[model samples]
Target: MNAIRIDIENVTVAYHGKVALHSASLQLQAGTICGLVGMNGAGKSTLFKAIMGFVQPAGGRILINGLPIRRVQKSSLVAYVPQSEEVDWNFPVSVHDVVMMGRYGYMNLLRIPRLSDQRAVREALERVEMWQMRDRQIGELSGGQKKRTFFARALAQQGKVLLLDEPFAGVDIKTEKMMIHLLMELRQTGHTILISTHDLASITTFCDQVVLINRTILAYGNTSEVFTAENLSRTFGGSVGDFSLATSQLAPGNQEEQEWT
Candidate 1:
């Protein structure tokens, strides 16, 4: 088996007095893409935040390559791309500058980007096909372009583990396909990726493993084993029959007409 790159062991998270996650545990092997699936407010983002060290767990711990998250972060072994909505588009930074921020982890205290850093930034941008627009302001680009810029930043970070939250949300089909291809390429190069997404149909298509969660982990394992109707229903809280109806209702044809809860 490949080495474990990310290990979340019985982690619990809370907000104020309410428990958001209850002893959730999952392990991600290196060179694989794992999909984090759940309905809205299912603690998917919370789990990602915990792994990224943005939230202190109430219990348990997260390990990156057998080391603690903080140590892994300091070594630039992990990179995160938050949901687009969480980002401030009016930050007044160029695309190249935003991508260059990934190199800050490797820079000195003065934060001066070296020639190697510039080369890395350039290569990342080119890989995502955003090099031509590197000079453009972030706010000026379309939704897909913004996503590409962030993905490029993650690539430039040169991290072995990548965490993304709702990266495919609100993206066009072409853009979604492009991102999926990029992720596959990254996986081939031995990068471990965990992407939180609501597109259940894409799980089988893109992920080698799936972790289903609702307040706590409902299921976690190979995609074929965990993404079944039964597991999805347990995660989403409905009968298999209801799940089928709900899934059909949320299909691409009806997605624009109805809002997903």
Candidate 2:
């Protein structure tokens, strides 16, 4: 059996008396890609924050590699890429500099990067095909380029797990494909990844597992098993009939059939 990389046990989160998540639980295996699917306010981001230790859970716990989240975080076992809207695009930093920030976790108080850090940053940028634009200001790059730069930063971190929120948003199709390919390669390299996205059509195509959440976990399992019409309807609060019709029209017939099969 594959070792579990992430384990969320009956976690709950709330703010100002409004419960964002209630008794949510999930488990992700090592070296696999899991897609988080849910509506806009279904507490997907809250769950990510809880696992990252940015938000304290009101109940239960989260474990990484059988250790507490805080312990895992201290070892730089996880990296996160937040939603694009949360970023300050106008920040005056070069692409290379932004990527180098990933190495800060290993740096001292002076924040000076070492030779090894520089080599890792260069390799990450080259892997993402962004090395040539290393000196360009972040604000001047196209949306796709900006996304790639952030991805390169995550790669430079060399974390065992990656959590990405809407990594495909606002990018062209080509860039989206590139990101997906990179994620798959990362999984093959024994890196566990969890991505929150609304692109339902790509779930079966790339993800090894799918998690459906709506204030809590509605379904979690292999992509081919949990992405059923019934589970999707529960997550989206739509009728299964409506979901099937919509999916049939929006996705390729074979893809839709695979999701249901």
Candidate 3:
């Protein structure tokens, strides 16, 4: 049987008395691509944060590799690619520099990059096909290239698990395909991947498993079974009759908003 990479049992999170996630439990198995799906205010990112130890839950437990998340900095076991919009695109840094930062977790307080660290960074860049553009200023790269650079940064961590938030949002088709291929390769190599996205088409076809979140976990399992019209309607506050119509109303500037899924 595949080992469970992450397990959340009866977890709940709240902010200023407003509940974000309610008694949510989930299990992410090794070597699988699981997608978190739901509309805004669905509490997907909050669930990720809880698993990453960024926020402590008010109840229940989160475990990573059979260890309590609070005892270990879960960041070392799982890599995170936060939403692109969460990053400052104007930051004055090179692609290589950003990728090398992933080594900080292994470094001491002095945090000097060693030869092995540089090699890992280089290999990570190569893995993402961004080695040639390593010296370019981060701000000068295209949106897709920038996303791949961060992805390389996460790869440099060499963790057993990966988590990405809206990775395919606002990218060219070629870059999207490249990212998907890389994710598939990661899965083949025994790494567990959990991605949160609202792209129902990709969820329907690309993902091995689907999880619907809306202030709670509505459904989770194989995509064919969990992404039903009934479940989508329950989690999305409406039917899947016209996902694009509802999504269009919130697309233009909604990227910058603090939404769940």
lDDT of each model, Cα atoms only?
Answer: 0.84, 0.84, 0.82
Candidates arranged by TM-score, highest first: 3, 1, 2
Evaluate residue 56 in candidate 1 and report its C-alpha lDDT on the 0 to 100 scale: 92
Candidate 3 per-residue lDDT, tens place, 115-185, comes to 98999999999988899999999989988898898889889988787899877777777877888888889
**Model 1 per-residue lDDT at 91:** 95
For candidate 2, list the clashing residue pairs, or say none. Answer: none
Per-model TM-score versus the true fold: 0.90, 0.90, 0.91
| Candidate scoring better on TM-score of 1 and 3 | 3
lDDT of 3 at 18: 80
Q: Which candidate has the highest TM-score of all? A: 3
On lDDT, who's better, 1 or 3?
Answer: 1
Shift of residue 142 alpha carbon in model 3, Å: 1.5
lDDT of 3: 0.82
Candidate 2 overall lDDT versus native: 0.84
Clashes per prediction? 0, 0, 0
Can you write out model 1's per-residue Cα lDDT over 201-239, one digit (the tens) per residue?
Answer: 777898999999889999999998888888887887877
Task: Kindly report which residue stretches of model 3 are placed more than 4 angstroms away from their true locations once superposed.
Answer: 1-4, 242-250, 253-261
